[model samples]
Target: MFVIITYDVGEKRVNKVCKKLREYLTWTQNSVFEGEITKSLLMKCLNEIDQIIDEDEDSIYIYEVANPKNIKKQVFGQEKNFDELFL
Candidate 1:
């Protein structure tokens, strides 16, 4: 599955959260990450994030491609320097 993750974390935890996400996704912008990930890997990523964040103070948003055939994903604005594929 493909996912776009955006996060808002406390100042102290921001670096920790960003580091965790880099293991699973591409850092697209400040506070933003997107890439393809397996369900198990996604869960692992979230679980790691869950440990680092204070639930009441931090927020994580996940946008997924529910139906690949019907939905098309597009990126507008400054183009990414890397190719779309990860490997």
Candidate 2:
């Protein structure tokens, strides 16, 4: 599965979340990451993130693409080519 993860986290805990995510995903933007990960690994990642974030102060969004080959991505400006990185 291909996953895109983004977070709005408190300043104090942002680095912790980012560091953990980088261990399993590719950092794509300021607080956005994307990569291919197994379902089990995805669950593990989420569990780890849950531990670091404050529920009321932080928010994490995960977009999962079960069939990446069927999706088309259009890039503008200087965005990195995620297709090349994740496909």
Q: Score every model by TM-score.
A: 0.81, 0.86
Candidate number with greatest TM-score: 2
lDDT of 1: 0.86
In model 1, state the lDDT of residue 5.
93
Q: Assess the local accuracy of residue 78 in candidate 1 as a C-alpha lDDT between 0 and 100.
A: 78
Cα error, candidate 1, residue 65 (Å): 0.8
Model 1 spans > 4 angstroms off? 68-77, 80-87
- Model 1, 27-59: lDDT tens per residue? 877898888899999999999999999999999
lDDT, candidate 2, 1-87, per-residue tens: 999999999999999999899889888777999889999999999999999999999999999999989779776788863435656
The best candidate by lDDT is 2
Clashing pairs in 2: none
